[model samples]
Target chain A: MHEFSLCEGIIDAITAQTCQQGFSRVRRVWLEIGALANVELDALRFAFEVVREDTIAASAELDIITLPGRAWCLNCAQTIAVGELYDPCPLCGGYQWRLTGGNEMRIKELEVE
Target chain B: MCATCGCGETEPVIHPHDHAPDHAHPHQHDHAHDTRRISLEQDILAKNAGFAASNRRLFVEQGVLALNLVSSPGSGKTALLSRTVQILRDEFPVAVIGGDQQTANDAERIIAAGAPAVQINTGKGCHLDAHGIGHALERLALPKGGVLFIENVGNLVCPADFDLGEAAKVVILSVTEGEDKPLKYPNMFAAAKLMLLNKTDLLPHVEFDVDRCLDYARRVNRELDILQLSARTGEGMEPWLEWLRRGRHDALIQQINQLEADLAAARSRLIHGGGAIRRTVI
Candidate 1:
C-alpha cells in the first residue's frame, strides 16, 4: 500500500529534523490528515510501526488528527461539509462545487528528547 | 556523593568524570534529558514535490509534453499508448516510461510500436514517485519538443497522490468496468484532467451505460474532459491524437516565449551596462 511509502516519507522527515535539531530520540509524532486525503489511518499506523523500526522514532507513538472535508457550493453560495469528492451538494443537490479543505497530509509536530 | 557507582557515600568523591554514566545516575548528566515538542508543520510529500518541481523545469526547458496515464489494471492503457505512439511517431518524437509491479511487457510492446520506451519495475511500490521518474529520465533520452508518456502503474488510489511532473494526468476507464467507478475512486478521477472511456467496441456486448458513467465522472470532477475510444479497433483515436498534438504545440510555444523573455532581459541588461552579463544557453 502507499501508506508504507508515506510512512517512509514521514520517517525521512523525522530523521532529517533529528539531525538538525540534535535530538537523540523521538517519543511521539503528530500528523494532520484530511478525510479526503485518501489515506487509511489504520494502514498508516501499521506502516508507521513497520517503518519506524531502528530509526529515531522506533518507539514513538503516532497521534493523528483528522480534518473534515469542506467545499464551497457554487449554487448554494455557501460552504458545505462534504464526505466525498463525488458527493453532490447537500443544499442544492448540485455537482458544481469547489473543494476548499480536507485534502492535506502534513506532519504537525514531534516530541523528542 | 558518588553518583556513578552509587557507592552510598554521603561525601563528594574527588575522582575525574571519565567513566560512562550508569543507568542509576539521575542528575549527574551535563544537560537535562527533557522532552521538547518541536513544531515542524511540514508537508510529508515535500521531498517528492521538490523532485517534481525539478522535473517540471526540465520538461519546460526541453519543451516536452509529458502526460501521465493512470488507470486500473486491464484498462488497455498499454494498448492505447502503443497505438498512439504508432500514429504520432512519424509526426514527432514519442517516448514512453511504463511503470508496473513486475514484467517489462508493456515496455516491449511500446518498443515494438516503433518508439523508445523504458520500463520501471516498482516492485513493492504501488505507485511511481517523482524521485523514481527523475532516475528514469536519466536512463531514457527525453523527447524534445514532443510527447513523453508516463504510463503509471495500473492503480487508481495511490497514483493520485504522487506527482510525476506530467503536463496532465489522463485516467482511462473501460466499459467493462462499473459505471460508478468514479464514485468509488473519486480521488483518482478528481486528480485527472482528462478521462478516456476505452473499450467502446465491447460496449454493445457489455451492459455499460455510457451516459451514466460520464455523469458520475463529471460529479467527481466537473472540469474533466471525456473521450470515448477503443484501442483495439482504432476507433475514435483521431480526437485523442489531436489533443496530444495540441498539447505539444502549446508546450513548444510556451518554451519559445520563455526563451524570448530571457533574450529580452539579457538585452536590457546589456543596454544598462550591468556587471557580469550572464548568457543562458537553451
Candidate 2:
C-alpha cells in the first residue's frame, strides 16, 4: 500500500530531524493529514507500527490531526467543505470548484528526548 | 552507569552540599529529563517533490512530451504502448520507461515495436517515485521534441500520489473491467488528465456499457478527456495518436518560447555592457 511508502518518508524525515536536532529518541510524532489526501488512517497507523521498528521512533506515539477538505466553489462564490476529490459543491451542485485546502501530508511537530 | 562508554559504573556521586545555591553542575545529576517539542511543519513528500521538479526542468529543456500511463493489472497498458510506439516511431523519436514489479517483458515488447525502452523493476515498491524516474532518465536518452511514455507500475492507488514530472497522466481502462471503476477509484480518475478505454474490440463480447462508463468518468473528473481504442485491432488509434502529436507540438512551442526569452535576456545584457561575453551552448 502507498501508506507504507508514506511511512517510509515519515521515518526518513524523522531520522533527518534527529540528526539535526541531536535527539536520541523520538517519543511522539504529530502529523497533519488532510481529508482529501487519499490516505487511510487505519492503514497509516498500521504502516507506522511496521515501519518504526529499530529506528529513532521505535516507541514513538503517532498523533494524526486530520484536516477537513475545503474548496472554493466558482458558481456560488464561497468556500465549501468537500469530503472527496470528486465531490460537487453542496450549495450549487456544480463541479466548477477549485480545491483550496486539504490534500496535505505534513509532519507538524515532534516530542524528542 | 555510563551507558555511552559502558564503564560499568552503576551510579555517579554528586555533592550538592559542597556547591553554592547558584552553582551549576558540570556533570550529570539527578534532574528532570525534559522532553522537548519541536515544531517542524515540513511536507512529507518534499524530497520526492524536489526530484520531480528537477525531472520536469530536464523534460522542459529537452522539449519532451512525457506522459505517465497508469492502470490496474492486466489493463493492456503494454499492448497500447507497443501499438502507439509502432505508429509514432515513424514520425519522431520515441522512448518508453516501463515499471513492473518483476519482469522486463513490457520493455522488451516496446523495444521490439521499434523504440528504445527501459524497464525499472521495483521489487517491493507499489509505485514509481520521481527519484526512480530520475535514475531511469540517466540510462535512457530523452526523445527531444517527441514522446517519452512512462508506463507506471500497474497500480491504481499508489501511482496517483507520486508525480513523475509528466506532462500529463493517462489512465488506461479496458472494457473487460467494471464500468464503476472510476467511481471506485475516484482518486486515480481525478488525478488523470485523460482516460483511454482500451480493448474496445472485446466490447461486444463483454457486457460493458461504454456510455455508462463515460458518464461515471465524467462524474469523477469533468475535464478528463476520453478515447475508445483497441491496440490489438488498430481501431480508434488515430485520435489517440493525434492527441499525442498535439501535445508534442505544444511542447515544441514552449521550448521555442523559452529559447526566445533566454536570447532576449542575453541581448539586453550585451546592450547594457554587463560583464564578459558568455555564450550559452544549447
Best candidate according to DockQ = 1
Q: Report the first chain's TM-score for all candidates.
A: 0.97, 0.96
- lDDT values of the candidates? 0.90, 0.87
Model 1 misplacement above 4 A: B1-30, B265-273, B276-282
Q: Write down the C-alpha DockQ for each prediction.
A: 0.57, 0.52
**Candidate 1 Cα RMSD (Å):** 10.5
lDDT of 1 by residue, A1-113 (tens): 89998998898888877545656789999999999998999999999999898787999999999999999999999999999998889999998999999999999999988
* TM value for model 1: 0.89
Give lDDT tens digits, candidate 2, residues B1-282.
343222234221222233343434222335545578999999988767877888887888889999999999999999999999998999999999999999999999999999999999999888998978887886899999899999999999899989889989999999999998998898899899999999999988999999999988987788899999999999999999999999999988888888889899988878787444443431
RMSD of 2: 9.0
Candidate 2 clashes between residue pairs 3 or more apart in a chain or in different chains: none
Worst 10 residues of 2 chain A by lDDT: A16-25
